[model samples]
Target: MTIHRAHIAGAALASALSMTSSANAQALEYQNTSGGSVTVYGQLNFGYLNFDDGESTTDEIVDNDNSPSRVGMALVQPFGDNQLRFRFETALGLRSSSGISQTEVPDGIDWDRTNIRHFDFAWANPNYGTISLGQGSMATDGVTGADDSGTDVISNVSVSDIAGSFAFRDSTGALTGVELSDAFSTFDGGRRGRIRWDSPEVANFTFSVAHGTEILDEDADTDYTDLAVRYGNDFGDFNVNAALGARRIQPSGSDDEDYVIGSVAVHHAPTGLSFAVAAGSEDGGGDYYYAKLGYARDFFAVGTTAFSIDYYEGDDINGAGTSSDSVGFSVVQSLDSANSEIFATYREYSYSDGTATSYQDANATMIGARWKF
Candidate 1:
């Protein structure tokens, strides 16, 4: 795999931050005499993107879709041994990198109901666990993204989020109409209008299940059912996190699709090293494997500095006899004083369709900052 020299330069620049500022980063909160509290929180992520589609290059400012900018509010009330919580969150709906392409650069902001991430309420009990209702995460959400690597702000198993809409080029330098998003997928679960339940933790293990449908999109009629198990623990100098999940999607009048996905991550505190692996299989469709190596340390008093490299491989994702693969390098530096992070990433994508037609690889580079308040 070829690493872009420009990306290395960008990483160096991103890592060279020396600015310091007073921190006013606490979430805005209000408390009522009734022993209830409401907290407001949000974050903004902005970035510069450079994409090379073999035939040409496109550069633009974008809202990093890797995380996106968003706002949210949480309300909590204690009831004996149980708690009642409500959350409302949505994306800012800026022009995101995942939505941009060589042929299309969306203009202005486009806010819609689809941007709603969580509008849900939950009741939690230490004995029975928690139950949630409304538009929120399904049981399998984040099941394929259990990573202890601090560099996830810029790199993860979801490789296509960076430049997903950019089309691939044929050997003749012509657009092949096959976008990275179409060719690569992690089969991870997502958020939806649903009812979910979680079992109380037992020896660091927890179980969850959910049932839901597509509610934000009026014309869509899809039902989702999922279950997941997660484990997390800190073993003195080492920490580990893992998850396994299964989901079934049934579209109106369409065949059902089933998926199983899992991931594990381990971090060694003394050495500041980490490793993560994820894999998934779609019933009769596609399968993928991903691995990442990472290192992190508090090289500066401000916060931790992290670096990571990852690889992904997929089989039959777009169609039978097709393959998609990618490699990525990333770095992230935390600015504790400002409650923000500066990050950079470089990635290369390749695909094959089992045909005689040859295609050129695509490269993407991004440098971004995320600030939370």
Candidate 2:
């Protein structure tokens, strides 16, 4: 099979740079005598995107939805072995790649209450773990997204974030009216107005549980509950992370929905090689598997350069008997001094509705930059 020249070029560049250390940017912070502190942080992510829907192509400037631009503040106070913290964060609400479609491009920034990511308060102690309330992550959030590849700034298992709004085309070059997002899913949990408790780590493992609702949607009546377990450890030259989670969703007037998800990632620090795998299934609905292979190294004095390739496959995602699959390549080059990264990724999507009519695959390419402060 023929490979895209862009992918080849990225691989070549990574190979050329593989000779160097990694560094990180710091957030702004202020502290008091009582060990109370406030910190502000944010990131800007933007990119150029080109999508081919088998017949026509679209090109535009978009905000990378994989990691959208946003700002936030954190406040912390410590007393003895116990600490209290508060967090407030929101998205900038710019037009995002996942929000754009083949026929429509939103006009401008549209900030709203839904853009809020976190409005949370928590109390923690080394001996007692933590308890949190308000709008924040559920217990299963990121449960299927364990990765140490270092290329996540550009790519991950949430494949549709690149061009989710684009419609698939049939063999005859007609729109099938089925968007990528409708056919692809990770079944991963998200943030909500909830109360959560996390148990203190024991033998490198921690347990979490949460109950929440759709507080941002005034008219919605849904409740969410989940349990998650996570483990992390470093052994000599290898590091590993793993997670398992289960969630239940109950609508006011409908039957409940349930899901289970898990992931594991391993990195060999000395060789800069990493691997990750994730899988999830929705009760009586759909199931999916995802995997990635990656490499990273300090190629320059500035920072590390990372590259990765990933694959995803799902059955009955959109409906019964349907299938969705995708393959992607990504690379990220870090600029330590500027606290930024320049990256690019290419992905191809395929879907089948279990019908007589065949559909063509969709292709998307993105080049972007992210700066954190």
lDDT of each: 0.89, 0.89
Q: Estimate the TM-score for candidate 1.
A: 0.92
Error of 2 at 235 (Å): 1.9
Off by over 4 Å in 1: 1-24
Candidate 1 residues 114-216, lDDT tens each? 9999999999999999999999999999998988778887799999998999999999998987999999898888999999999999999999999999999
After superposition, candidate 2 runs with Cα above 4 Å error: 1-25
Candidate 2 clashes between residue pairs 3 or more apart in a chain or in different chains? 17-299, 20-298
> Any idea what lDDT model 2 has?
0.89
